[model samples]
Target: MEALSEVKLGPCRDSPYLRPLRIHYTQNGTRKHWDFMQTHDSVSILIFNTTRQSFVLVKQFRPAVYMCECARRGIMPTVDTASKDCSPQSLVAGELLPASAGVTYELCAGIVDKSDLSLQEIAKEEVLEECGYNVSVGNLQKITSYRPRWLQQEGTEAYRRGTNRHTPTVCAGEPSAADYWAAGGECRGHRRS
Candidate 1:
């Protein structure tokens, strides 16, 4: 996995992936507000390797998870902190958490930003790009769909089931695959218990 060093944090001025917004509404004759982020719907695939009796998973470092761990450990500012400046120097100066704190194992997934492709197609592409496995769209079984109560307002997440019949061929040549590897991310199989 990628090692974290010289970490820095700052305000997100603009992002194509997500937009933060607050909604004002009247509930039970009382006015209330809810803050959330508008993001593209996404798809996640659970890849099972029948040959190896394992699950294919991706391991990567998540900055958000790292920051949360830091805040929980009292080494960084919490989300409710009054100060908005989140520069590295503004955080607990000289204190740093191990990179392992941010490492996470996750299912192969991707955001649904393309308007032309179906959810199954997106899942197939994600499985190939992230997990280095070529899977047909027809083989992707839609398990269920749900919306997370977090910052994902109105964004639906679809989970699909995929089976890997052969060994993974890492597509390191693909731009997306290369980018993930360049950032110290990796794909591996976890034996099922």
Candidate 2:
């Protein structure tokens, strides 16, 4: 006979955006439990330009990752979020690395929620917001549905979901006019009117 295991999950704290939870399961007939964070499904866009032969990405400061790094180096602790209120996110206020170290380079991405817009439409919007690319949803080619690493790291929700990514495109508009694509350097363009 094969052994089986049952898993139980419940929220530990109430947050408007995210729900951190406690998960209990059976492993080799032994009961085990883990704490994690849960969030809505999301989409990521890969903005690459063929004319410039470059990829567009974003840089943002992530508190959780930085706090964890600090904790690892004995600089500080991860702020036992599982125990205290995780709602404010002010818990990670411990000594953290410089802002430069916390900044991460990432692709254009956003959470999926607006019911009116289609998945492709959402991807188009994210590309525009994060990468400043004005392109139509039709122009976006479906690449694959990928769960972001940070999302997975926060918690392992049993909910099966997919995040659509657009395939590579030469240029949504005039190739020469696009601002983001650089031959082999950083993109200085931000918040274009």
Candidate 3:
């Protein structure tokens, strides 16, 4: 269910998701500046399927991952670095990166942008929307929270839940469990003990 096509790159001047920021500060009397993006906090749910003895994950194409893979493979185009003209045509006719290059397996996650919903509520909604599991907010066990230095914003509070319900169903435009399993990996940082 992951297909990325007609790829293009452009400068982002405004976005509802993130804001570019530069902070100037003095560390040990040395002036320093760091550029980062300010974004909403997020939550990730590790859906453990007790019946299957495996974890249920989400698989989707990440453009950032694709671009990084292309760059690493030395196949990315170098034209119009600051503009939106970077498209498939910018590279050799057959140089497009494979769709799988961008694919990633991750926990069901969503941003904490709704003001009226509590963190657990948002997590519950994400589980239903992304993973098609109707898990109650009370069943979500908080594991930990940590902010990634690169994002420079509030961290994601991780949760885990064990479910023996029927196989997960896919919401519209969401990846199916087959794709998730095909992507193949355990939930990072969490292992069966």
C-alpha TM-scores of all predictions? 0.67, 0.57, 0.65
Pairs that collide, model 3: none
Candidate 1 total steric clashes: 0
lDDT, candidate 1, residue 155? 38
lDDT of 1 by residue, 49-145 (tens): 6556566677767778999898788876434334566443445546888878987887777787888987778887777666666666776777766
Q: Which stretches of candidate 2 lie over 4 Å from their true place?
A: 1-14, 23-36, 77-96, 146-193
Clashing pairs in 2: none
Residue 18 C-alpha lDDT in model 1: 73
Lowest summed lDDT across 10 adjacent residues in model 2 is found at 1-10
Q: Which rank order by lDDT, best down to worst? A: 1, 3, 2
**Deviation from native of the Cα of residue 37 in model 3, angstroms:** 1.8
Estimate candidate 3's alpha-carbon lDDT, on a 0 to 1 scale.
0.59
lDDT of 3 by residue, 118-172 (tens): 7778877777666555566776766666644333323422111211111122222
Each candidate's lDDT (Cα)?
A: 0.60, 0.53, 0.59
